[model samples]
Target: MSDKILIIDDEPGIRSSLRGILEDEGFNVQAVASGEEGLALIKRENFDVILLDIWLEGLDGLEVLKKLKEEEEKAQVIMITGHGSVETAVRAIKQGAYDFLEKPLSLEKVVVTVKNALHQKKLEEENLILRSKFRNKYQKLVGESPVIKELKKKIAKAAASKASVVIYGESGTGKELVARLIHQQSSRKNKKFIHINLAAIPEHLLPRELFGYIKGAFPEAASDKKGKVLLANGGTLFLDEIGEINPLLQIKLLHLLEKGIIEPEGSLEPIPVDVRIIATSQVNLAPLVRAKRFRDDLFFKINVLPIVIPPLRERKEDIPLLIDYYLDYFSLELGKKKKTMTSAAKKAFLNYSWPGNISELINVIERFVIMVPEDEIRPEHLSLLVEPRELQLTPQNNHILSLKEAILHFEKEYIHRRLMTNGWEVKRTAQELKVTPQELKEKIRSLGIRIAD
Candidate 1:
């Protein structure tokens, strides 16, 4: 669609000239005789840009501009005048005119100014969309399981205090989601929420990445940089996979926790930071701390407000609700009609152990919504389950092992296949095998099975 331009001028010649020039440039131009007509059009329709003359019949251009400002209008307005002066331009700008143009307006200048204004409007619109998405992602925690309800109650309490939080959960168990929820619900909701994954950063580059450096701080420190702590000042900093951080950095981090201050590389001055810390770990930190891999004192400092999220298997009742939620979400996202699962299909999903958790379920839902042409998802549609069950063993191979060995081998293979199908969600896989999650973990360890990425 072409850009919409509104021309409000008293002179017939000026209106005609602008209309011709703008239309030729592929704009949808509408020329009005006075400010009243322009205001009426603005109320009824949307325009990308408006050209208003300073002198109009009933209401002057400045008055119209003031009214637009009061109404919180979004279009970019350029003031047009035959008697242009520094004072008039300044007044027009203060009244919310994007730019001012005198009579004998240059066609080139008009086009350039309009383009710049449009660009600025586009950026603002994009920012609004990003913020909306950010809000929607952390606005609420999904599911109605008892554990989920308990977590919500704890989150409210945690948000009320300024103490550092340490969230413990397995992979794909919504640890980061909980962190974001805390930030969204806390008083720092309007401020930045910076996240850094300790596991993702290389050991050699960890210091530079966490505590940014000044120019020539190191061989590769080309210019000055602001670290996550400084960037998250007056906000929250999420340190994901905190156990993966090396011991040296842990000491420095402990100091930062004691006194909300940071000294950038090659700088001696301490820069105070008012940042809230939210850390997450997938493994038990106590074991690592016992092994001297993680600092004990540092652990105590961050463990002030601890939150532990149970794996999905422990809350099996929420599976159906999660499935329905993902189905609706994916259907809308993929622009397809919402699909329903057959009772048998739902049962198959319910029985299967989900090794991957909610993230894995979402991927499966997206695949079914997009790939399956039928509106109903049946048991046959679940290839992850049906296909794996088809694996067979020959009598010649079966005779090689004792009954006990054959059972162990079968159990190991069955559990491994289910884990792969569910993206390695141990709790879900355990439920499928009719074994405790701890039993499945031990079996996986005993059988020497390595999960594929």
Candidate 2:
């Protein structure tokens, strides 16, 4: 079917001209003499794009746009008027109008704007479908541990409400996963769930990235840019590592939370948005607030619904279950038979503190599935992967060793652990260890540590 276009103008000539133009462009066009008629027709049918006139008989274009938004209409509206101003255009955009146009209308500009609006509408629909499918694929939170059960309860509660949430957890403890689960189960599940890592973005560029900017906002800004916050309007914005946000940005964020509006760069107009913030942080914000690094008001605002995820070390009981699940999952994913671990190796895994948490465990399991040829993974196979903290050193033995021997022993163990964590990449491990690769190679040779080719 051809794309449908609805024209709402008080002037018969303008309506007829727009209808003719759109119809000639292969659109199924409908013309109405007033906004009232256009709205009535919208109630009866669906249109891909609506060409609305600012000056109407009963209801004006802005009022109609407001009604369309209130009704949650999917059609993209392009507002047109013979008398147009920057204020009017900003007002139309703030009220969710796709684009603003002036009359005597440039027919070519209308066609291009309408096509762009239709294209955007199609992309949004496709995104919703894709998000639905993704939500269906990974809806459940794994593990039957008591902490996990309690976490699930909190998640369900958070989902049922439209409150800001701050998820506190260590790195790799699935903070993002929990955030996504909350978004998936929330009232806004059908809308977009945009995730922005505050830590990943440079501090200088963060405001523009989150709040967007108008055309020519900066030297490099050649066109208008929609930020993640606007993109997540009527949905959830997952601010990953939100603790990394600077003091200035925090104030802006606080303003957004307090007032449901954001001012794009280079524009005085503040666009109203309905965005629920779901922020994840590995660090506690209280200390940052006390230090004056983070805004206290902002912290309190976002901490309305605080959900703390226990690190894997605290929930060691879930290790076996996670191991089984990942083993089965990675085995199937890698097209290999399921692998089993010896009781001793499992004991070592449970004993070792997984500083990297669930993510580290997953990496180790995946590595084993790919590298280990045998179905039965033994303690020796885990030697390089698992840190030797499992082997407790007696106080008497420590006293027997000299200072140099103890230093050498600790250095070797630490280097080996770092190597294993970095997949034995000498360059990466050296960078992390703050040493030159050549120096690390010398240490590795002197220590007689074996590395896989």
Q: lDDT per model, in order?
A: 0.79, 0.82
RMSD for all candidates, in order, please: 14.8, 13.5
Model 2 segments more than 4 A misplaced:
1-140, 384-453
Give per-model TM-scores: 0.61, 0.62
Model 1, 98-209: lDDT tens per residue?
8888888888887888788777776765586476654443244678989999999989999999999999998878888899889878988756688999899899887777
For candidate 1, the TM-score is: 0.61
The model with the greatest lDDT is 2
